[model samples]
Target chain A: MSIPAIASTRNDALASLLDNAINNKTKPLGSLGMLETVAKQIGLIQNTRVIALEKPAILVFAADHGVVAEGVSAYPQDVTWQMVENFLARGAAINVFAQQNGCALHIIDAGVNHDFGPRTGLTDRKLAHGTHNFAQQPAMSSDTCATALAAGMALVAELDGNVVGFGEMGIGNTTAAAALMHKLTGIPVAQCVGAGTGLSADGISHKQRVIEAAVALHASATEPLDVLATFGGLEIAMMVGAMLKAAERRMVLLIDGFIVTSALLVAARLQPAILDYCVFAHCSDESGHKKMLDNLGARPLLQLNLRLGEGTGCALALPLLHAAVNFLNQMATFESAQVSEKSE
Target chain B: MSIPAIASTRNDALASLLDNAINNKTKPLGSLGMLETVAKQIGLIQNTRVIALEKPAILVFAADHGVVAEGVSAYPQDVTWQMVENFLARGAAINVFAQQNGCALHIIDAGVNHDFGPRTGLTDRKLAHGTHNFAQQPAMSSDTCATALAAGMALVAELDGNVVGFGEMGIGNTTAAAALMHKLTGIPVAQCVGAGTGLSADGISHKQRVIEAAVALHASATEPLDVLATFGGLEIAMMVGAMLKAAERRMVLLIDGFIVTSALLVAARLQPAILDYCVFAHCSDESGHKKMLDNLGARPLLQLNLRLGEGTGCALALPLLHAAVNFLNQMATFESAQVSEKSE
Candidate 1:
């Protein structure tokens, strides 16, 4: 399968208009700082001087990765399914943040091992229940990778908002994300690996070795999807597909953490245009996230050291998106407020 | 009048409980990142594991400084009264952000040169129609400084919230804040001066020169109050008073921008315990703000490069305060979610 076409480019005319509009707002010019940047980016993306985030939603993909068997994660593989249930029950940190920020949440089971079976708010689009252990074999076939990507794209197409945040929950997926980062960026696996789910120093080194061995096995994989099929989790593939679709639909894609960004790296390689639609939510303390963000030249909204991958960063940044839009629309201009501008 | 004593120390016992509670959240340990730090700080401040921000108010003090006559700021001093009027009309950035975050805003006429007679939502606490020309003479008499401090203390006493944010509006007050920062932190005047209200490079140098000249004039002023009386704007003096009162009452104080922190430096000096009650809201783009934050060993929640300085930073951060408190109070524990904890 080929990468989907993304044709939208940022509207420079609207961006300049936003700049003038933001500067004329009763405050000092450029005093809104990063908010002015946010306002401009959104205005340019939507191609409008009048911008607002309407019906924002968080799309969270949950799956299992084959690498958990290598003892790369501190939590057991079953915890993935258990946490998905927790998300369904609205009892996780993501749920609390989503509720706090008024963001609608849709959790997807891309390829978790357990059968959730017709749960509300859960999109069951499992890709072969779980991928093949990439340590011994390709994580999934090229066809399965395409299916996962299409599933993600389809899931996003069903969402109601023009702005959406992406997150994922899968034990050992960080190992997959790290491996993908290493393969794509060629940053060593040691720097890419981190203490996912609270691994100790020794555990991290061991996880590093597992990822390194897996990378060696997949030496023949060179294409983006081939690499994804080699080392990516099912959820990551879907997210890569969903991100492209979201960008195609011109939705604001809120990208979260290391796993989400690894998928984003795949999506970016597939279609560099997708970067225009993305807003990094935070810099996770998770290893390699900073490097990934640096590689993309993206500045995230928050830096809260959050490594929880269940779309929590997306939920946290929802209000900030609201502020950016609302400030652009609602803030009184100098003329409107009859306030004096700075004198020369 | 004497400086009010602030007796509140961070509650260590409750902090330990909060640490345990936060660590046991369904998310991985330390995964919540800055949110966990925020939760711990609030829990310690309130001396309770269960915390809530009730009746959060942004106390915005607006006054004029005599320093504007020296051409030390980018905007004319009349803009101070104009902005206060804008605040009352809900046409300012502070008003928009305050409304967005549901923070009750109390705009004070600390010493604006204009008479905004009998306005609702405007607290009339004039401090002698702004300060004297500090470049030529002491900005305020010691007697006026005492009255300003007492008024700020009285105003906080009348307010209904246990959580409050401090903000100020005064043209040329950045010069005053820079001068105050120079005096308190002993940093050079040039480093503390910046493009306040859109000053050009020449303007900043001129402002720096004006500040240096004033600091030289007040070389004999040694005590904090003496320094405040010598160089502080009425709003700064009042904020110092209000901050001390807020700390004495054990209310959480959200400190904003350069001018507000300059006032807080005075307050903290008067009573070191006041630092225990304060939360740095954002690192303002104002030149001296980072130094001021560093002087206090504070880590501000946001770094949006905002320099608008009307408690706007406080308002932007109000939702985050809510997130921190609500997440602590509302997120299901690992036990409640029945999710397995990270195995040792």
Candidate 2:
């Protein structure tokens, strides 16, 4: 898929709603802290009383990478497929979070090495059981990239709801995501790679070296999607697609940690339209997330030193999104509540 | 209220369910991280195919203290009421979080020294408008303490929710919380007192001295509640009551911030059963919370350097609780999914 179209926004309406909400609040100007802006934004977007959050949704995508055998990830390649099974079986962290927050969870097999044939539960949208090794060559060809994008858009089309979250599971995906983030954001791969699944200190160094090599191989690519086709796993490509669809649908995109954010960066680079709906779930303890978030100018909802992937960060963020929506919809207005502001 | 009871936990049933769930999953043991135990506990309690989370709630109790006049807080008394208004107007960070997480917010007027009246929208449960200056004399009388407890318990009865959170909005409350925790934990007030609203280095030193003096004033108190009744804010007493009722109802208690945790310490001392239902929402950057958490053997889920209260931590925790229920219900059996798992 080509870049998503940047939709026109009602700046006047959003600005007015923000300005009105702040002025009407009982607190001194800017005293409500981060919440002050959230209320305003919600008020602007929904175009009415921001009340009642409904149909929270979490989207977890899983894929495989050739880099797993290179010792970039702490866990083995089997862990990715194992976690996908866990997610489908509703035993994963994201599954638990989705349940707790009243979110309908949908897990997609974006790509993995093994066939999960005849499985009734898994959303089998695999784009070749894992991609070509980035160490030797591009992860997937251009045709596979288009197929992955289509698969992502398909998932979002089916699950349009109040908020959409993107979570990922892959053993060596961090090396893959960091490489893509570097290609799109112009940050070096070393700055973007992190311990994917509990990598040792030495494992991180090896992962860094692997990422640098991949970046070195793909340095001359001019286009973002081409870079993704070069180093992006099916999960990353699919996440980029899902985010675009969420943007088009005007759904809030709850972005998980490092790998997901790297996907977000790729999606945003391809289509600046996506940034409007994106909320960084957390600044992962992973070293690369900060630079990616800073480059995207994203403000994450949590900073729990969390590096657990599989959309756990995104699942955690589900509550914050509802909070934003609830305040936007609920809360008595200055006139309705009949509360007096300070002397000002 | 009498000391409360914990949920009738079928620990054996829970352990059995966990064994079955993990054995059936497609991953090795402990691959799901903290979520594994969480799922088993949910299965035990709900005893169903689908665990449902409902009645998410937060109690943000606001007040002011004469201690602020002594410059114990970095912000003025006005900010206390101002933040309360922010909470009521859904403009504070906690408000946004509460709204996002589907946690019903109940901001109480425990004693802001400002007349919220019946029309103020905040539930007017004030105890003497505000406490007497704790530095000079006891913050409140024993009768006032009883009244605060009554107010918190009454609110719990009215909200009738599945989960409860306790947070405070008094400007100088942290100083009082620190002094209380110091007395309870037998730690020095200097170690417990923290910067309440960004105190300068000189201001922190001065605040520590003031807390030391207050602790000295209360050192001879015969009992915990008596000490609290003498020096704690009306809101703190009310939280003890609120927490008691929450535990009695078997609703999960989400403990927030330093001041609120101090109330938990008081309530738990009065009845240890209340401790079983509590989930420490966060460790505030405030100096006291870490010590309080450690004393309780409680590990907080978030550590965002947040000092602003109003049940913000609970609001953030809403999603994790949501996840806990989902995993208990949604995961399928190994036979059904045909997934192979490693034996422990």
Best prediction by TM-score: 1
Task: Pick out the ten consecutive residues of candidate 2 chain B with the lowest summed lDDT.
Answer: B335-344
Q: Candidate 2, residues A286-316: lDDT per residue as tens digits?
A: 7888898999988776766667677777776
iRMSD for every model? 1.1, 5.6
The TM-score values for the models, in the order shown, are 0.98, 0.74
Q: Provide the lowest-lDDT 10-residue window in model 1 chain A.
A: A1-10
TM-score of model 1 (first chain only): 0.98
Instruction: Report the number of the highest-DockQ candidate.
Output: 1
User: In CAPRI terms, where does candidate 1 land?
Assistant: medium
Clashing pairs in 1: none
lDDT of 1 by residue, A1-344 (tens): 45679866667677778889998888998898888888888887787888878888988898898878787889888889999999989888888989988989988899999988898888888876777788899999989999989888888888888899998999999999998999888888989989887899999999999988988888999888899999999999999999999898888889989999999999998898888888888899997899989998899888878899898989888778888888888878889878887789
Model 2 C-alpha lDDT per residue in residues B1-344, reported as the tens digit of each score: 34445555456755675667655543333444444554454444445434566788788888888787788765567767766766766666676666655667777888888876575557888777788887888888777787778778888887756777887788778778877887788887678877666676788889889878876776676487887876688788888898888777766778887888999889877877666677777777777788899998877776555555777777776666665555545655545555443211
| Clash totals, every prediction | 0, 18
> DockQ (Cα-based) per candidate?
0.78, 0.18
In model 1, the runs with Cα more than 4 Å from the true position are none
